[model samples]
Target: MKNGIEIMNVEQTFNGKKVLNGINVKIEKGEIFGLLGPSGAGKTTLIKILTGQLKQTEGKAEILGKDARKLTGEDYKKIGIMMDNFGLYERLSCFDNLKLFAKIYEITDDEISGILKEVGLLEAKKALAMNLSKGMRNRLQLARVLMLKPNILFLDEPTSGLDPATVDAIHGLIENERQKGTTIFLTTHNMAEAEKLCDNVALLNEGKIVEYGNPKELCRKYNHQKKIKLHLYDGQNIELEHDKSVAKILNRYFEQGLVETIHSTEPDLELVFMELTGRKLDK
Candidate 1:
Protein backbone atom coordinates (compact mmCIF):
# COMPACT_ATOMS: atom_id res chain seq x y z
CA MET A 1 0.00 0.00 0.00
CA LYS A 2 1.12 3.51 -0.79
CA ASN A 3 1.96 5.83 2.07
CA GLY A 4 0.24 9.15 2.51
CA ILE A 5 3.33 10.87 3.94
CA GLU A 6 6.95 9.67 4.08
CA ILE A 7 9.96 11.26 5.75
CA MET A 8 13.35 9.77 4.91
CA ASN A 9 16.19 10.66 7.25
CA VAL A 10 14.91 14.23 7.38
CA GLU A 11 16.98 16.75 9.30
CA GLN A 12 16.65 20.43 10.18
CA THR A 13 18.82 23.01 11.85
CA PHE A 14 18.38 26.55 13.15
CA ASN A 15 21.12 28.85 14.43
CA GLY A 16 23.53 25.91 14.59
CA LYS A 17 21.11 23.89 16.71
CA LYS A 18 19.72 20.69 15.30
CA VAL A 19 15.95 20.79 15.55
CA LEU A 20 15.36 17.52 13.69
CA ASN A 21 17.95 14.84 13.22
CA GLY A 22 17.60 12.02 10.78
CA ILE A 23 13.87 11.68 11.35
CA ASN A 24 12.06 8.87 9.58
CA VAL A 25 8.33 8.26 9.61
CA LYS A 26 5.67 6.86 7.33
CA ILE A 27 2.00 7.75 7.61
CA GLU A 28 -0.17 5.22 5.83
CA LYS A 29 -3.01 6.40 3.66
CA GLY A 30 -6.28 6.87 5.50
CA GLU A 31 -4.66 6.55 8.92
CA ILE A 32 -4.57 9.28 11.56
CA PHE A 33 -0.90 9.56 12.53
CA GLY A 34 0.11 11.74 15.49
CA LEU A 35 3.31 13.52 16.45
CA LEU A 36 3.31 13.80 20.23
CA GLY A 37 5.69 16.23 21.88
CA PRO A 38 5.86 19.29 24.08
CA SER A 39 6.60 22.88 23.13
CA GLY A 40 10.05 23.56 21.59
CA ALA A 41 10.38 19.88 20.76
CA GLY A 42 10.53 20.57 17.01
CA LYS A 43 6.95 19.50 16.39
CA THR A 44 6.12 22.71 14.56
CA THR A 45 9.38 22.59 12.61
CA LEU A 46 8.61 19.08 11.41
CA ILE A 47 5.12 20.05 10.35
CA LYS A 48 6.45 23.02 8.41
CA ILE A 49 8.88 20.81 6.55
CA LEU A 50 6.22 18.21 5.80
CA THR A 51 3.83 20.85 4.43
CA GLY A 52 6.52 22.49 2.25
CA GLN A 53 6.43 25.67 4.31
CA LEU A 54 10.12 25.14 5.13
CA LYS A 55 12.89 23.11 3.55
CA GLN A 56 14.72 20.39 5.42
CA THR A 57 18.41 20.96 6.01
CA GLU A 58 19.09 17.37 4.94
CA GLY A 59 17.21 14.30 3.66
CA LYS A 60 13.75 14.41 2.16
CA ALA A 61 10.00 14.19 2.68
CA GLU A 62 7.39 13.08 0.20
CA ILE A 63 3.71 13.90 0.48
CA LEU A 64 1.29 11.89 -1.61
CA GLY A 65 4.22 10.36 -3.58
CA LYS A 66 5.66 13.75 -4.61
CA ASP A 67 8.69 15.35 -3.07
CA ALA A 68 7.33 17.80 -0.50
CA ARG A 69 9.61 20.59 -1.69
CA LYS A 70 8.65 20.01 -5.32
CA LEU A 71 4.92 20.39 -4.76
CA THR A 72 3.15 22.88 -7.01
CA GLY A 73 -0.05 24.87 -6.79
CA GLU A 74 -2.04 21.91 -8.08
CA ASP A 75 -0.54 19.72 -5.41
CA TYR A 76 -1.65 22.12 -2.66
CA LYS A 77 -5.24 21.71 -3.73
CA LYS A 78 -4.99 18.10 -2.64
CA ILE A 79 -3.71 19.04 0.82
CA GLY A 80 -5.05 20.95 3.82
CA ILE A 81 -3.24 22.38 6.84
CA MET A 82 -4.31 23.90 10.18
CA MET A 83 -2.01 25.32 12.79
CA ASP A 84 -2.42 27.30 15.99
CA ASN A 85 -0.62 30.39 14.71
CA PHE A 86 -2.58 30.52 11.49
CA GLY A 87 -5.55 32.69 12.42
CA LEU A 88 -8.61 33.51 10.38
CA TYR A 89 -9.59 36.96 9.16
CA GLU A 90 -11.43 38.43 12.14
CA ARG A 91 -13.17 41.11 10.10
CA LEU A 92 -14.72 38.76 7.57
CA SER A 93 -17.90 36.77 8.08
CA CYS A 94 -17.49 33.03 8.45
CA PHE A 95 -19.27 32.48 5.16
CA ASP A 96 -16.97 34.85 3.33
CA ASN A 97 -13.89 33.40 4.94
CA LEU A 98 -14.77 29.89 3.84
CA LYS A 99 -15.75 31.07 0.39
CA LEU A 100 -12.50 32.94 -0.07
CA PHE A 101 -10.43 29.92 0.92
CA ALA A 102 -12.52 27.67 -1.30
CA LYS A 103 -11.81 30.01 -4.20
CA ILE A 104 -8.12 29.80 -3.45
CA TYR A 105 -8.32 26.01 -3.48
CA GLU A 106 -10.58 26.11 -6.50
CA ILE A 107 -13.31 24.35 -4.53
CA THR A 108 -16.92 24.85 -5.49
CA ASP A 109 -19.47 26.86 -3.50
CA ASP A 110 -21.46 23.71 -2.83
CA GLU A 111 -18.43 22.07 -1.27
CA ILE A 112 -17.82 25.09 0.98
CA SER A 113 -21.41 25.09 2.28
CA GLY A 114 -21.31 21.34 2.80
CA ILE A 115 -18.09 21.58 4.78
CA LEU A 116 -19.45 24.41 6.93
CA LYS A 117 -22.49 22.31 7.78
CA GLU A 118 -20.32 19.26 8.39
CA VAL A 119 -18.31 21.15 10.99
CA GLY A 120 -21.50 22.36 12.70
CA LEU A 121 -20.99 25.99 11.66
CA LEU A 122 -23.79 26.42 9.16
CA GLU A 123 -25.91 28.49 11.54
CA ALA A 124 -22.99 30.81 12.18
CA LYS A 125 -22.26 31.16 8.49
CA LYS A 126 -22.87 34.88 8.41
CA ALA A 127 -21.34 35.60 11.81
CA LEU A 128 -18.10 37.57 11.73
CA ALA A 129 -15.05 35.51 12.49
CA MET A 130 -14.23 37.74 15.48
CA ASN A 131 -17.71 37.30 16.87
CA LEU A 132 -17.38 33.53 17.15
CA SER A 133 -16.12 31.89 20.30
CA LYS A 134 -12.66 30.40 20.49
CA GLY A 135 -14.06 26.91 20.04
CA MET A 136 -16.11 28.04 17.09
CA ARG A 137 -13.07 29.64 15.50
CA ASN A 138 -11.19 26.41 15.96
CA ARG A 139 -14.00 24.53 14.25
CA LEU A 140 -14.01 27.07 11.44
CA GLN A 141 -10.33 26.52 10.91
CA LEU A 142 -11.06 22.83 10.49
CA ALA A 143 -13.93 23.62 8.16
CA ARG A 144 -11.62 25.68 6.00
CA VAL A 145 -9.47 22.62 5.48
CA LEU A 146 -12.46 20.41 4.74
CA MET A 147 -13.72 22.78 2.09
CA LEU A 148 -10.88 21.68 -0.14
CA LYS A 149 -11.61 18.06 0.70
CA PRO A 150 -7.88 17.41 0.63
CA ASN A 151 -6.57 13.89 0.64
CA ILE A 152 -4.00 14.80 3.34
CA LEU A 153 -4.39 17.11 6.34
CA PHE A 154 -1.75 18.50 8.69
CA LEU A 155 -3.22 19.59 12.02
CA ASP A 156 -1.03 21.10 14.74
CA GLU A 157 -2.40 21.41 18.24
CA PRO A 158 -5.89 21.15 16.84
CA THR A 159 -7.40 21.24 20.30
CA SER A 160 -5.53 23.36 22.78
CA GLY A 161 -7.55 25.17 25.45
CA LEU A 162 -11.08 24.10 24.59
CA ASP A 163 -13.34 22.32 27.05
CA PRO A 164 -13.73 18.56 26.95
CA ALA A 165 -17.01 18.65 25.06
CA THR A 166 -15.58 20.88 22.34
CA VAL A 167 -12.50 18.75 22.12
CA ASP A 168 -14.65 15.68 21.64
CA ALA A 169 -16.57 17.49 18.93
CA ILE A 170 -13.30 18.25 17.17
CA HIS A 171 -12.29 14.62 17.48
CA GLY A 172 -15.55 13.58 15.90
CA LEU A 173 -14.91 15.97 13.04
CA ILE A 174 -11.48 14.42 12.52
CA GLU A 175 -13.02 10.95 12.57
CA ASN A 176 -15.64 12.01 10.07
CA GLU A 177 -12.96 13.39 7.80
CA ARG A 178 -10.91 10.21 8.13
CA GLN A 179 -13.92 8.09 7.17
CA LYS A 180 -14.07 10.09 3.96
CA GLY A 181 -10.52 8.80 3.15
CA THR A 182 -8.58 11.84 4.36
CA THR A 183 -5.19 11.08 5.84
CA ILE A 184 -4.70 13.11 9.03
CA PHE A 185 -1.33 14.05 10.52
CA LEU A 186 -1.97 15.34 14.03
CA THR A 187 0.58 17.09 16.26
CA THR A 188 -0.34 17.90 19.82
CA HIS A 189 0.95 17.75 23.40
CA ASN A 190 -2.39 16.47 24.57
CA MET A 191 -1.78 12.76 25.06
CA ALA A 192 -5.47 12.06 25.47
CA GLU A 193 -6.20 13.76 22.19
CA ALA A 194 -3.63 11.66 20.37
CA GLU A 195 -4.81 8.44 22.00
CA LYS A 196 -8.40 9.22 21.15
CA LEU A 197 -7.74 10.20 17.54
CA CYS A 198 -4.54 8.71 16.18
CA ASP A 199 -4.09 5.16 14.94
CA ASN A 200 -0.36 5.44 15.61
CA VAL A 201 1.85 8.07 17.27
CA ALA A 202 5.52 9.02 17.28
CA LEU A 203 6.98 10.63 20.37
CA LEU A 204 9.37 13.47 19.63
CA ASN A 205 11.77 15.16 21.99
CA GLU A 206 14.77 17.44 21.40
CA GLY A 207 14.01 17.32 17.68
CA LYS A 208 14.17 13.55 17.37
CA ILE A 209 11.80 10.63 17.65
CA VAL A 210 12.24 8.79 20.94
CA GLU A 211 9.47 6.27 20.46
CA TYR A 212 6.89 5.33 17.91
CA GLY A 213 4.06 2.77 18.01
CA ASN A 214 0.38 2.21 18.62
CA PRO A 215 -0.73 3.95 21.83
CA LYS A 216 -1.86 0.73 23.50
CA GLU A 217 1.30 -1.06 22.50
CA LEU A 218 3.58 1.67 23.85
CA CYS A 219 1.61 1.89 27.10
CA ARG A 220 1.77 -1.86 27.64
CA LYS A 221 5.43 -2.01 26.69
CA TYR A 222 6.47 0.67 29.13
CA ASN A 223 4.23 -0.37 32.00
CA HIS A 224 5.25 -3.74 33.45
CA GLN A 225 2.84 -3.44 36.36
CA LYS A 226 -0.89 -2.91 36.59
CA LYS A 227 -2.97 -1.43 39.40
CA ILE A 228 -6.53 -1.40 40.63
CA LYS A 229 -8.23 1.19 42.80
CA LEU A 230 -10.83 0.29 45.40
CA HIS A 231 -13.25 2.97 46.56
CA LEU A 232 -14.60 2.03 49.95
CA TYR A 233 -18.01 3.04 51.21
CA ASP A 234 -16.36 4.84 54.08
CA GLY A 235 -14.62 7.27 51.69
CA GLN A 236 -11.34 5.43 51.84
CA ASN A 237 -9.46 4.86 48.61
CA ILE A 238 -7.07 1.94 48.47
CA GLU A 239 -4.90 0.85 45.57
CA LEU A 240 -4.00 -2.76 44.98
CA GLU A 241 -1.20 -4.08 42.82
CA HIS A 242 -2.39 -6.31 40.02
CA ASP A 243 -0.62 -9.64 39.82
CA LYS A 244 -1.47 -13.32 39.89
CA SER A 245 -1.13 -13.47 43.66
CA VAL A 246 -3.01 -10.22 44.13
CA ALA A 247 -5.85 -11.46 41.95
CA LYS A 248 -6.56 -14.27 44.33
CA ILE A 249 -6.33 -11.91 47.30
CA LEU A 250 -8.73 -9.48 45.64
CA ASN A 251 -11.19 -12.26 44.96
CA ARG A 252 -11.03 -13.33 48.60
CA TYR A 253 -11.50 -9.75 49.73
CA PHE A 254 -14.69 -9.46 47.68
CA GLU A 255 -15.84 -12.89 48.81
CA GLN A 256 -15.26 -11.85 52.46
CA GLY A 257 -17.15 -8.56 51.93
CA LEU A 258 -14.01 -6.48 52.47
CA VAL A 259 -13.93 -4.90 49.01
CA GLU A 260 -15.99 -2.02 47.66
CA THR A 261 -16.22 -0.61 44.15
CA ILE A 262 -13.14 -1.74 42.29
CA HIS A 263 -11.71 -0.30 39.12
CA SER A 264 -8.72 -1.47 37.12
CA THR A 265 -6.17 1.13 36.06
CA GLU A 266 -4.19 0.63 32.90
CA PRO A 267 -1.33 2.71 31.57
CA ASP A 268 -2.68 5.48 29.41
CA LEU A 269 -0.94 7.63 26.80
CA GLU A 270 0.23 10.11 29.42
CA LEU A 271 2.05 7.32 31.23
CA VAL A 272 3.59 6.13 28.00
CA PHE A 273 4.71 9.67 27.18
CA MET A 274 6.45 9.98 30.51
CA GLU A 275 8.10 6.60 30.12
CA LEU A 276 9.51 7.56 26.75
CA THR A 277 10.38 11.20 27.42
CA GLY A 278 11.49 10.84 31.02
CA ARG A 279 9.06 13.56 32.10
CA LYS A 280 5.39 13.77 32.90
CA LEU A 281 3.21 14.76 29.98
CA ASP A 282 1.27 17.29 31.99
CA LYS A 283 4.48 19.17 32.71
Candidate 2:
Protein backbone atom coordinates (compact mmCIF):
# COMPACT_ATOMS: atom_id res chain seq x y z
CA MET A 1 0.00 0.00 0.00
CA LYS A 2 1.69 3.21 -1.12
CA ASN A 3 -0.80 5.31 0.89
CA GLY A 4 -0.72 8.04 -1.73
CA ILE A 5 -1.70 8.87 -5.32
CA GLU A 6 0.16 7.74 -8.42
CA ILE A 7 -0.67 8.43 -12.02
CA MET A 8 1.31 6.86 -14.84
CA ASN A 9 0.95 8.26 -18.33
CA VAL A 10 -2.67 9.13 -17.68
CA GLU A 11 -4.54 10.55 -20.63
CA GLN A 12 -8.17 11.50 -21.19
CA THR A 13 -10.07 12.53 -24.28
CA PHE A 14 -13.58 13.65 -25.11
CA ASN A 15 -14.82 13.29 -28.67
CA GLY A 16 -11.25 12.69 -29.82
CA LYS A 17 -10.02 15.91 -28.24
CA LYS A 18 -7.36 15.24 -25.61
CA VAL A 19 -8.01 16.91 -22.29
CA LEU A 20 -5.11 15.32 -20.45
CA ASN A 21 -2.03 14.14 -22.27
CA GLY A 22 0.45 11.68 -20.90
CA ILE A 23 0.13 13.13 -17.41
CA ASN A 24 2.41 11.48 -14.86
CA VAL A 25 2.92 12.36 -11.22
CA LYS A 26 3.27 10.87 -7.77
CA ILE A 27 1.92 12.39 -4.57
CA GLU A 28 3.29 11.10 -1.28
CA LYS A 29 1.22 10.39 1.78
CA GLY A 30 0.33 13.51 3.79
CA GLU A 31 1.59 15.72 1.01
CA ILE A 32 -0.23 18.77 -0.35
CA PHE A 33 -0.05 18.56 -4.13
CA GLY A 34 -1.45 21.26 -6.36
CA LEU A 35 -2.60 21.06 -9.98
CA LEU A 36 -2.42 24.61 -11.23
CA GLY A 37 -3.64 25.90 -14.58
CA PRO A 38 -5.94 28.33 -16.28
CA SER A 39 -9.50 27.51 -17.35
CA GLY A 40 -9.87 24.68 -19.86
CA ALA A 41 -6.38 23.42 -18.93
CA GLY A 42 -7.56 19.93 -17.90
CA LYS A 43 -7.07 20.36 -14.15
CA THR A 44 -10.65 19.35 -13.35
CA THR A 45 -10.46 16.49 -15.80
CA LEU A 46 -7.38 15.11 -14.11
CA ILE A 47 -9.02 15.42 -10.71
CA LYS A 48 -12.07 13.58 -11.88
CA ILE A 49 -9.90 10.73 -13.12
CA LEU A 50 -7.96 10.62 -9.86
CA THR A 51 -11.13 10.54 -7.78
CA GLY A 52 -12.79 7.84 -9.89
CA GLN A 53 -15.55 10.09 -11.10
CA LEU A 54 -14.36 9.64 -14.66
CA LYS A 55 -12.26 6.99 -16.34
CA GLN A 56 -9.17 7.98 -18.24
CA THR A 57 -8.83 7.24 -21.91
CA GLU A 58 -5.41 5.66 -21.30
CA GLY A 59 -2.91 4.75 -18.60
CA LYS A 60 -3.55 4.29 -14.91
CA ALA A 61 -4.43 6.25 -11.76
CA GLU A 62 -4.05 4.83 -8.31
CA ILE A 63 -5.44 6.41 -5.19
CA LEU A 64 -4.52 5.08 -1.76
CA GLY A 65 -2.77 2.19 -3.45
CA LYS A 66 -5.87 0.97 -5.29
CA ASP A 67 -6.64 1.39 -8.96
CA ALA A 68 -8.83 4.46 -9.45
CA ARG A 69 -11.06 2.57 -11.83
CA LYS A 70 -11.74 -0.04 -9.15
CA LEU A 71 -12.50 2.19 -6.17
CA THR A 72 -15.18 0.77 -3.90
CA GLY A 73 -17.73 2.37 -1.62
CA GLU A 74 -15.31 1.91 1.27
CA ASP A 75 -12.62 3.61 -0.75
CA TYR A 76 -14.91 6.57 -1.31
CA LYS A 77 -15.54 6.76 2.43
CA LYS A 78 -11.87 7.48 2.89
CA ILE A 79 -12.02 10.41 0.47
CA GLY A 80 -13.37 13.92 0.99
CA ILE A 81 -14.23 16.25 -1.89
CA MET A 82 -15.08 19.93 -1.90
CA MET A 83 -15.92 21.44 -5.23
CA ASP A 84 -18.16 24.10 -6.77
CA ASN A 85 -20.97 21.68 -7.58
CA PHE A 86 -20.85 20.07 -4.13
CA GLY A 87 -24.43 20.95 -3.39
CA LEU A 88 -25.90 22.19 -0.13
CA TYR A 89 -29.49 21.83 0.98
CA GLU A 90 -30.55 25.43 0.74
CA ARG A 91 -33.62 24.88 2.87
CA LEU A 92 -31.67 23.26 5.67
CA SER A 93 -29.91 25.11 8.45
CA CYS A 94 -26.16 24.87 8.65
CA PHE A 95 -26.38 22.59 11.64
CA ASP A 96 -28.94 20.39 9.96
CA ASN A 97 -26.89 20.19 6.80
CA LEU A 98 -23.91 18.98 8.78
CA LYS A 99 -26.14 16.68 10.78
CA LEU A 100 -27.18 14.94 7.57
CA PHE A 101 -23.57 14.15 6.65
CA ALA A 102 -22.70 13.33 10.23
CA LYS A 103 -25.36 10.69 10.24
CA ILE A 104 -23.99 9.28 7.02
CA TYR A 105 -20.47 9.27 8.45
CA GLU A 106 -21.75 7.92 11.81
CA ILE A 107 -20.48 10.97 13.68
CA THR A 108 -21.98 12.65 16.72
CA ASP A 109 -23.56 16.10 16.99
CA ASP A 110 -20.71 17.11 19.25
CA GLU A 111 -18.30 16.51 16.39
CA ILE A 112 -20.44 18.60 14.08
CA SER A 113 -20.48 21.50 16.54
CA GLY A 114 -16.74 21.26 16.99
CA ILE A 115 -16.04 21.47 13.27
CA LEU A 116 -18.50 24.30 12.82
CA LYS A 117 -16.70 26.25 15.50
CA GLU A 118 -13.38 25.49 13.95
CA VAL A 119 -14.64 27.00 10.68
CA GLY A 120 -16.08 30.04 12.48
CA LEU A 121 -19.64 28.95 11.79
CA LEU A 122 -20.84 28.00 15.27
CA GLU A 123 -22.80 31.23 15.63
CA ALA A 124 -24.49 30.59 12.30
CA LYS A 125 -25.26 26.98 12.95
CA LYS A 126 -29.01 27.56 12.82
CA ALA A 127 -28.94 29.84 9.82
CA LEU A 128 -30.43 28.53 6.60
CA ALA A 129 -27.90 27.73 3.92
CA MET A 130 -29.63 30.00 1.44
CA ASN A 131 -29.30 32.96 3.79
CA LEU A 132 -25.66 32.56 4.69
CA SER A 133 -23.09 34.75 3.06
CA LYS A 134 -20.80 33.28 0.40
CA GLY A 135 -17.96 33.05 2.89
CA MET A 136 -20.13 31.30 5.43
CA ARG A 137 -21.42 28.92 2.78
CA ASN A 138 -17.85 28.15 1.79
CA ARG A 139 -16.94 27.52 5.43
CA LEU A 140 -19.88 25.23 5.89
CA GLN A 141 -18.85 23.24 2.83
CA LEU A 142 -15.33 22.94 4.25
CA ALA A 143 -16.67 21.87 7.62
CA ARG A 144 -18.71 19.22 5.91
CA VAL A 145 -15.58 17.69 4.38
CA LEU A 146 -13.31 18.16 7.41
CA MET A 147 -15.80 16.45 9.68
CA LEU A 148 -15.36 13.30 7.62
CA LYS A 149 -11.71 13.08 8.65
CA PRO A 150 -10.92 11.31 5.41
CA ASN A 151 -7.42 10.17 4.51
CA ILE A 152 -7.52 12.04 1.17
CA LEU A 153 -9.05 15.43 0.41
CA PHE A 154 -9.79 16.92 -3.02
CA LEU A 155 -10.30 20.67 -3.16
CA ASP A 156 -11.12 22.33 -6.50
CA GLU A 157 -10.83 26.08 -6.48
CA PRO A 158 -11.76 26.16 -2.81
CA THR A 159 -11.11 29.87 -2.43
CA SER A 160 -12.22 31.18 -5.77
CA GLY A 161 -14.19 34.43 -5.68
CA LEU A 162 -13.73 34.64 -1.91
CA ASP A 163 -12.83 37.76 0.03
CA PRO A 164 -9.35 38.05 1.48
CA ALA A 165 -10.50 37.40 5.06
CA THR A 166 -12.57 34.43 3.98
CA VAL A 167 -9.72 33.07 1.91
CA ASP A 168 -7.41 33.46 4.90
CA ALA A 169 -9.85 31.56 7.08
CA ILE A 170 -10.08 28.78 4.53
CA HIS A 171 -6.31 28.64 4.24
CA GLY A 172 -6.08 28.25 8.01
CA LEU A 173 -8.50 25.35 7.91
CA ILE A 174 -6.51 23.74 5.11
CA GLU A 175 -3.23 24.14 7.05
CA ASN A 176 -4.83 22.48 10.05
CA GLU A 177 -5.85 19.56 7.85
CA ARG A 178 -2.28 19.28 6.53
CA GLN A 179 -1.06 19.09 10.12
CA LYS A 180 -3.40 16.14 10.63
CA GLY A 181 -1.54 14.19 7.90
CA THR A 182 -4.33 14.30 5.34
CA THR A 183 -3.17 14.01 1.73
CA ILE A 184 -4.64 16.99 -0.09
CA PHE A 185 -5.02 17.25 -3.86
CA LEU A 186 -5.81 20.81 -4.74
CA THR A 187 -6.73 22.21 -8.16
CA THR A 188 -6.59 25.93 -8.61
CA HIS A 189 -5.61 28.66 -11.04
CA ASN A 190 -4.51 30.96 -8.24
CA MET A 191 -0.72 30.98 -8.24
CA ALA A 192 -0.35 32.72 -4.88
CA GLU A 193 -2.60 30.25 -3.14
CA ALA A 194 -0.77 27.32 -4.71
CA GLU A 195 2.60 28.79 -3.71
CA LYS A 196 1.44 29.14 -0.14
CA LEU A 197 -0.26 25.75 0.28
CA CYS A 198 1.31 23.26 -2.11
CA ASP A 199 4.44 21.32 -1.22
CA ASN A 200 4.76 20.40 -4.89
CA VAL A 201 2.78 21.61 -7.89
CA ALA A 202 2.26 20.71 -11.53
CA LEU A 203 1.69 23.56 -13.90
CA LEU A 204 -0.87 22.32 -16.43
CA ASN A 205 -1.39 24.12 -19.67
CA GLU A 206 -3.20 22.97 -22.83
CA GLY A 207 -3.55 19.46 -21.45
CA LYS A 208 0.09 18.98 -20.58
CA ILE A 209 2.32 19.55 -17.57
CA VAL A 210 4.61 22.40 -18.47
CA GLU A 211 6.44 22.39 -15.15
CA TYR A 212 6.45 20.53 -11.87
CA GLY A 213 8.36 21.01 -8.60
CA ASN A 214 8.30 22.63 -5.20
CA PRO A 215 6.83 26.11 -5.72
CA LYS A 216 9.69 27.96 -4.08
CA GLU A 217 12.29 25.84 -5.81
CA LEU A 218 10.61 26.44 -9.17
CA CYS A 219 10.68 30.16 -8.49
CA ARG A 220 14.34 30.08 -7.61
CA LYS A 221 15.14 27.90 -10.61
CA TYR A 222 13.60 30.50 -12.89
CA ASN A 223 15.34 33.41 -11.19
CA HIS A 224 17.67 34.18 -14.13
CA GLN A 225 18.52 37.81 -13.42
CA LYS A 226 20.53 37.22 -10.22
CA LYS A 227 20.15 40.86 -9.30
CA ILE A 228 19.41 42.87 -6.20
CA LYS A 229 16.64 45.47 -6.14
CA LEU A 230 17.29 48.27 -3.66
CA HIS A 231 15.55 51.42 -2.46
CA LEU A 232 17.48 54.40 -1.06
CA TYR A 233 16.59 57.05 1.49
CA ASP A 234 16.25 59.67 -1.25
CA GLY A 235 13.49 57.55 -2.86
CA GLN A 236 15.89 56.30 -5.54
CA ASN A 237 15.59 52.73 -6.77
CA ILE A 238 18.42 50.65 -8.19
CA GLU A 239 18.77 47.21 -9.75
CA LEU A 240 22.29 45.82 -9.65
CA GLU A 241 23.76 42.45 -10.49
CA HIS A 242 24.48 40.39 -7.40
CA ASP A 243 28.23 40.18 -7.94
CA LYS A 244 31.40 40.99 -6.00
CA SER A 245 31.96 43.93 -8.38
CA VAL A 246 28.88 45.63 -6.89
CA ALA A 247 29.94 44.94 -3.27
CA LYS A 248 31.70 48.28 -2.92
CA ILE A 249 28.73 50.26 -4.16
CA LEU A 250 26.32 48.32 -1.88
CA ASN A 251 28.63 48.81 1.12
CA ARG A 252 28.86 52.54 0.38
CA TYR A 253 25.08 52.88 0.39
CA PHE A 254 24.82 50.95 3.70
CA GLU A 255 27.76 52.87 5.19
CA GLN A 256 26.01 56.12 4.34
CA GLY A 257 22.73 54.79 5.84
CA LEU A 258 21.06 55.43 2.48
CA VAL A 259 19.66 51.97 1.84
CA GLU A 260 15.97 51.79 2.68
CA THR A 261 15.13 48.25 1.59
CA ILE A 262 16.63 45.51 -0.52
CA HIS A 263 15.20 42.42 -2.13
CA SER A 264 16.50 39.54 -4.22
CA THR A 265 15.16 39.34 -7.75
CA GLU A 266 13.80 35.83 -7.43
CA PRO A 267 10.66 35.29 -9.53
CA ASP A 268 7.40 34.28 -7.91
CA LEU A 269 5.30 31.25 -8.85
CA GLU A 270 3.19 33.23 -11.33
CA LEU A 271 6.26 34.53 -13.04
CA VAL A 272 7.74 31.07 -13.19
CA PHE A 273 4.54 29.69 -14.70
CA MET A 274 4.49 32.47 -17.25
CA GLU A 275 8.12 32.00 -18.14
CA LEU A 276 7.51 28.30 -18.72
CA THR A 277 4.20 28.40 -20.60
CA GLY A 278 4.24 31.93 -21.98
CA ARG A 279 0.78 32.36 -20.46
CA LYS A 280 -0.60 33.72 -17.23
CA LEU A 281 -1.88 31.29 -14.63
CA ASP A 282 -5.15 33.18 -14.34
CA LYS A 283 -5.77 33.35 -18.05
Query: Candidate 1 has what TM-score?
Result: 0.91
**Local accuracy of candidate 1 as per-residue lDDT tens digits, 1-283:** 2549999999999999999998999999999999988888899999999899999999989998999999898888888999988989999998899988777667787787788888889899999999998889999999988777789999988888898888988999999988998999999899888888889999888888999999878877776667888877677888888777887877777887866698777688877777677877545
Please, what is the whole-model Cα lDDT of each candidate in the order they appear?
Answer: 0.87, 0.92
Off by over 4 Å in 2: none
In model 1, the worst 10-residue window by lDDT is 274-283
Instruction: Tell me the TM-score of each prediction against the true structure.
Output: 0.91, 0.97
Q: Which stretches of candidate 1 lie over 4 Å from their true place?
A: 1-3, 232-238, 253-260
**How many pairs of residues collide in each model?**
0, 0
Error of 2 at 1 (Å): 6.8
Tens digit of per-residue lDDT, candidate 2, span 79-198? 988888878999999999999988987999999999999999999999999999888988999899899898999998999889999999999999999999999999999989999999
